[model samples]
Target: MRLQDLSAALSDLESNHRLRRRATLASPQGVDIVVDGQSYLSFASNDYLGLADHPALALALQQGVERWGAGSGASHLLTGHSEAHQRAEEALARFVGREAALLFGSGYAANLAVITSLVGRGDAVFADKLNHASLNDGCLLSRADFQRFRHNDMAHLEQLLAASAARTKLIAVDAVYSMDGDEAPLPALLALAERYDAWLYVDDAHGFGVLGGGRGAAAEHGLASERLIYMATLGKAAGLAGAFVAGEGLLTDWLVNRARTYIFSTAQPPALAAAVETSLRLIEEGDERRARLAQLAARCRERLDGTRFAGGASRTPIQPFIIGEDAHAIRLADSLRRQGYWVPAIRPPTVPENGARLRISLSASHEPAQLDALLDLMLQASG
Candidate 1:
């Protein structure tokens, strides 16, 4: 870990095309944006409902700053938690059909908080192989006996559950896989949780504000249980910053008192909380937006049906066209960027080795013609 060693590591990453870079965004997040001084029809955002730059949300943010100021001076346990945060938390809890909820700065921190506080060395945690990195890190850091099931494999999970002799057992999964865009078997997982007397933790970062009429993945599955602990991000389809973990009342009580991330971190700005309040109302009334998003995704899938970059089993907006090599995926993304489309190439360790892809992130703001034009250019490139 010396400076020279770090430099060597960086060089190794670049040589293998594993280096990462950030584009300079000159405009707000939406389909049409200026990244690195170029205007582009972009498909590189998670703003599924296209509300990131909504006038009302922007105005609400401004008003929030006027009412509360720039930052919360302390953590929630001190004086940082505001009336805005309280109201937002209450709304979030009700929206997700939970007895309570606790806000966090980001989904990563939320996952860590949930995992670490609930389990220790005497406990056990079973996770999906494809769960988000944060979840994996959380489990590793929890000092729990960590067991991983094959992706979406219930029998493996059951075997692990049946074999564990720990004081407590928890099952962790993503409601919708972030990269693949497929859903977990929540009903079956819940049945196993009930059968094994374990807790179920669901990270629904990519499903909220788009599924279940914006009530979230839990509602979409028509499932509920006191055993379920749910976390959804506000920054995705909700078009705001922060996350909230919701579940039975006592669960939140434990997090508030025991979760290190929440107890130690400064609260998100009051402006963000106010904007989230506005975003929640918008998400609840966003049926038209969701419909448009679904239509756009379906059309793109249809257009790519016979192409080399055919769609996978994803039903959500995250359509990944796996190119199998880092260099190839980067080249495809670069070619698209030159043509005024801004698709992103995703490579490891974000995905498995040799599974690099052009991640097509769709939004309700996208028009059919825009998508069609991109696909035509794509087909030309691949052809």
Candidate 2:
């Protein structure tokens, strides 16, 4: 509890190669950034559609700030929620085919609100083993009997569902695994949830604006919105801030009333909501960007497929090359940085032990020449 104890804990983390350090960004969130006064071709960001620095989105934010000022100044339940927020929530609900939607400060808080609000102590919550940390924390907060099925393994989920107490069970998963860049078997999971009369909650943070022609995983697979809860972050492919939870009216109403994260936190600035709305509109109409990005990702994977450093099977903008050890991953990332590419090292806790990797993220803004340069540097680094 003492500061000395905290320092000792930090030391322990560093010793175990689990300490996290911060990176300085001298540019806006986008395909390229300036760090330490040097420009780097960034492949470590989540701005998949490359709208983070989009001119239209910036204009919208500027106009919104002029109209709505800088802050919401309160929570939604208070006086914080503005007309911009309301319209953006409605727009997102319609985009995702949901009856209603509620905006949260971030995706992490939105997951916390949904799980804790829906599942109670006597209920059961089933989750994917490789789901985002927020969902894992949500289950912990629910105080319910938490169960994790094998990653993307529907059979294991079904088995767990069959043997569950048949109480109110909620199955939670990420539509696409963030670190692994693989999609969940959503159809199978939805079928099982229906058979067991359980609610299915999906966090599509990485899928929205990057999948389903930019509508996300549920739309990609033509799944309806009934008895299903979907949450997505705007900061990823949308290149904006905040998150939204979309579902039927009752589900959203319940969250508005009971979800502590939404009730207690200051609403995201109206300017951010406007910017996100703009980004969503562009994503819906920017099919060419999506296609180009997908093609680029596929090309990168194809070129790296047989290499010893490549860990293939990634179909999304996120690609990871395994290095087995933390030091090796760090070394490779450093080497890539020296070659002018800004790739980040993924270590344990973000990933599992011996699963350290270089998380290569692609953006629509990146050119073929950049990709070629990246590959050349990476191949040389591997050697």
Candidate 3:
């Protein structure tokens, strides 16, 4: 009976065109790759700076393994923390202009640790409607009085803040919204946080290593505040695994002592930390890569002009092309895949209902010809 129920649910998902399928990648991440035994020019990766397969990063990772072996061997509080971890934390904090930073194995864990540890039942967490799923999960797990404002509606957020009587208030938002490829107004949100005496949490997963000269969105906005808790993932533009949360010294200490995800989970392999240290240097000096990425993004958007997909508002590498219906989105994805392009259709739950889209992720490694070709195919399919 239980199996039948589960199967029925899966069938519902399939019939509604909301079921997800994973394609096996038989090659390293980059612009061109093999998925499901077929080669494709992919616009589906988060490797924005084109460093995922770089020789320099590979060398650092190999060197780190030689020095630290493969694993940390225990949770951080016990014997897991190592010199490699310490050095990476220091470098991350310094790069993001914070006093300290704490590393986590993934962005979801980092968000969970920060949200759950910082607020509780009596506290209130204000969030944007379009925040990432990890953030939403954290808010729910925290048991905090969670309230969400309309997407980018500053006035609504302010209203919620003013009305909350909870002594501890937190405003959590994605610096750059993933599915929509839109950025939250950080400066404006910070002002509200200051006025309301609340903590402002900025999750810059999509902005770090690509925005603000590779210092991230806060640096992009020239924002530095004790009230701001900044978190970013290394897996996206950083072209590595894991995530980090940077802020005041006390926050790091508190998380070290209290964050359940940190306390209970084994530390990420120390070798990854050494690689991240190298990634930091590369990201800091990656002006040319960022410039190329910008040019590519601009060109992609410019080419979409005067089409049904015109006015692609994102200035970032993530450009979402809305397709309205689920089946149509799947068809478009199939069409692109058949044309040797690997753009996936983002459907319900990952996006709003009737807001299915092809999440066209761009990379600096992508040649202009590849992008132009993909865009032309997309326009043809849409037409």
Candidate 4:
């Protein structure tokens, strides 16, 4: 509890090779970043659309600041929620084909709001083994009878659902597995949920603004609004910040009333909400950007023809190259950094042990020459 004890714990983290370092980016987030004063090609960012440093977003932010000033100063139910927030929420609901939506300060907050609002002490929550940490934390906070099925295994989920004795059952999953870059068997999962008479909640943080013409995984699978409660973030492919939950009006209203995260946290800045609105517009209209990113991802996959890396099959922008061990993955990341590439090593706790990997995320702004150069480096490294 003391400073020295905290220092000792921090020292232990370094000794165990788990000390996290923050990278300072002098330039805006994009295909490249100026980290520690040196520019490097980036594969670590979630900016799949390459719109973070875009002119439109910049202009929108500037104009938004001029109109809305700075922070929201209080929680949504207080004096914080503005017209901009309402408009952004509405746009997101329409985009995801849901009846209504509610915004949260971040993706973590959105997950907390959804899970806690839906599941409780007597309720059961069945989740994927590999879902994001936010979802895991949400389950814990909800005080639900939390159970995890095998990753993407519907049979296991069904068995768990059949055995559950709770009054309400909630099936929680991610549309895209964050580290593995694989999609959930959404259609099968939805069908199973319906059969078991369970509510399905999907966190489409990675899928939204990247799949189904930027509508998300549920949309990609042609799953309707009634099939699931969806959550999406603006920080990923949308190139913005904050998150939202989209579903039936009653569910959203329930979240507004029951979700502690939404009730307690300070509302996001009105200017940021305005910026998110601009990002949504770009996402809805930028079909060519999405198409080009798909082509780029396919090309990159093709270039990795004969490598030891076992990246799972994913059509999304996130591509993982497994490195087996944490130390080796860190070393490879160091080597890549030395070579002016900015791909970071995904290590244990964030992922399972021996699942350390290089998460190569693509962007529409990546040039052909950059891809060729990266491929050449990968080939040399593989050899």
Candidate 5:
């Protein structure tokens, strides 16, 4: 009976062209990669600054292992928290201009810890419709009155905020929308949070090491307030693993005491923390990489202009070519793959119905000729 049910569900997904498949990577993450023994010019990674395989980061990881070993052997409140972890947290807080910071194993864990710790049965969580899955999951896990406003629509957010009577209200948003590559209106959201007496949570997973000169989206908009709780993942542009939450001293202390994910999960390896510290330094000094990424993204947009493929108004490294139907997007992706590209088809429930797209993620390591070749291939595939 269980096998029958599972088969039925899988059949439904396959019929809809939404059955997800994982690719096997045999090479380091970069513009060029070997997937399942085949080399491809890839645009499917979130390594925006192309630091994932940096020699400095690898060296730091090596030194960290030599100094601290592999595992933490416990949770943060237990015996897991190491000097390297503390130092990384301090560096993250300072980098984001926050009073304090707490590290988590991943961005999902950090979001769960923050939303669940701060809001509960009597409180509320107001989020954007296009927020990352983790944010929505955190809201559901909190058992809070979860309300979703239209994507980047301030009026809808304000309307929801005005209607909510919960004593504690939290506004959660992505600093940069992961799929669309557009940014949230931080200033307006901050203003609304202040007016409504809500806590504003900014998840800077895609923005931290790539935006605001490496400070992030909130910093880009000059938004620094006690009511703001900031989260950033290091695995992307940082070229390391883990995430951190930054906020006021009191708030971080509260999370340290109350966030179950942080209190229960085994602490991340101390060596990773050491590597993240080095990654932070590299990100701060990675202006040239950022510029290269911007140039690549601009070139992509310029070429795609006046084409049916152009989808969103994103100035960032993420460029989506909307194909509307799932099958069409999948076919386009397969066509590109056949021609030695590795762009993936993003389908629902990753996106809304009829909103399947090719998520063209740009990295600084991508060359001009490669970008031009990709443009030609995309045009040919679409044609």
Candidate 6:
């Protein structure tokens, strides 16, 4: 496209209230941050366990830098993989109860690697309609006979799986829906995968380090199986960088050999992996933090139950108050910002059309007074 055409397209996005902008954070990931020279009580981070700024993790990173330097300097197939990376991979495998695990640059890269490496032109891939964009992109890039069932509709998923005649079938879903804050019915999905003899791939990016006593949705639901491929990001609740895909030994080996993204991309910094090791230890023992987070979530839900900004049935920290119009959601977010709160306005294509919302991501680091104050602000703004 021409430069003028690109500018016109940008103008169209702005006119439709869909133009996205980046926020400059002048502080670390925490409940309080300085953004664009203004301080705010932020509720827009994915640091659910509040380990993003933990001292222990910081110390671990420093130790790692002293030992392994800052960067991996190459891809895993080359000299990039370090002892730190290997330890993290082994730790992740144990945490998720998988036979083997492989690290990737990010959750997106891991999903792309899994979907593309496992299935090809003659195979079939079934996905949830509300799966993350990365999952959808993986399906499309795989060149498989891709099919999307309705969101969380197991009956539809079963129907699709039963009707498919491909030599290989893969069912991909998110353990927890990012935007809606609801969980996938893993038991039912696993049964369907078994009945149809297909692989079940789950992206637990939002569930890991926050669910199942910090083991993630698979452990929370007791849905582990040989056919399950579990992928989780470390950047969210683990408060670190990168992602890992865990599965049986053969599958993990296949991904390491065939997944182009993993093969070609530079390995993540060894210092980050060392820090992630500390984060994992914290997550495993963070019962008090999780309990506090649950209390805070319940309080927020109860306070907003009868309000216009009520959220869905989410037991997780990701509570989203749906606002139908883009402008209205933006206005509410702006109002919250003006009041020193930093809940973000989530709009399409991040969400579906008419599903714009205020994505309130809670953290264990958030104080009770902050939650109460946010509830009060929400009521006032909605009114």
Query: Model 2, which residues run further than 4 Å from truth?
Result: 309-311
Tell me the lDDT of model 5 at 262. 93
Residues 1-383 of candidate 5: C-alpha lDDT, one tens digit per residue = 69999999999999989899899999988988999999999999989988999999999999999999989999989899999999998999999999999999999999999999999999999999999999999999999999999999999999999999999999999999888899999999999999999999999999998899988998888888999999999889898888999999999999999999999999999999988778988999999999998888788888888888665737898988788899999999998898899999999988888989888898889998998998898787777
lDDT per residue as tens, model 1, 1-383:
99999999999999999999888999999999999899999988999999889999999999999999999999999999999999989989988888898899999999999999999999999999999999999999999999999999999999999999989999999998888788899999999999999999999999999999998889999888999999999899999888999998899999999999999999999999988778989999999999998898788788888777665636688887778889988898999998899998899999999889877788999999998898787678766
> Could you estimate the TM-score for every candidate?
0.98, 0.97, 0.98, 0.96, 0.98, 0.98
Model 4, C-alpha of 205: deviation from truth (Å): 0.8
Q: After superposition, how far is residue 352 of candidate 1 from its true place, in Å?
A: 0.5
Q: Each candidate's lDDT (Cα)?
A: 0.91, 0.88, 0.93, 0.87, 0.92, 0.91
Where model 6 places Cα greater than 4 Å from the true spot, the runs are 308-311
lDDT accuracy of residue 229 in candidate 2:
90
Q: How displaced is residue 133 in candidate 2, in Å?
A: 0.5
Weakest ten-residue segment in model 2 by summed lDDT: 305-314
Tell me, by lDDT, which candidate is best. 3
How much does candidate 1 score in TM-score? 0.98
By TM-score, the better pick of 1 and 2 is: 1
lDDT tens readout by residue for model 3, 1-383: 69999999999999999888778999999998999899999999999998899889999999999999999999999999999999999999999999999999999999999999999999999999999999999999999999999999999999999999997999999999898778999999999999999999999999999999999999999999999999999998998899999999999999999999999999999999999878988898899999988888888779887777766548899998998999999999998888888999999899998999998898989888888888888888798
Q: Which stretches of candidate 1 lie over 4 Å from their true place?
A: 307-313
Q: For every candidate structure, what is the RMSD over all alpha carbons to the true structure, in angstroms?
A: 1.2, 1.3, 1.0, 1.5, 1.1, 1.1
lDDT comparing candidate 1 with the true structure: 0.91
Candidate 6 scores a C-alpha RMSD against the true structure in Å of 1.1
lDDT, candidate 4, at 74: 91
Better of 4 and 6 by lDDT: 6
Which residue pairs collide in model 1, if any?
none
Q: What's the C-alpha lDDT at position 232 in model 4?
A: 90
Between candidates 1 and 4, the one scoring higher on TM-score is 1
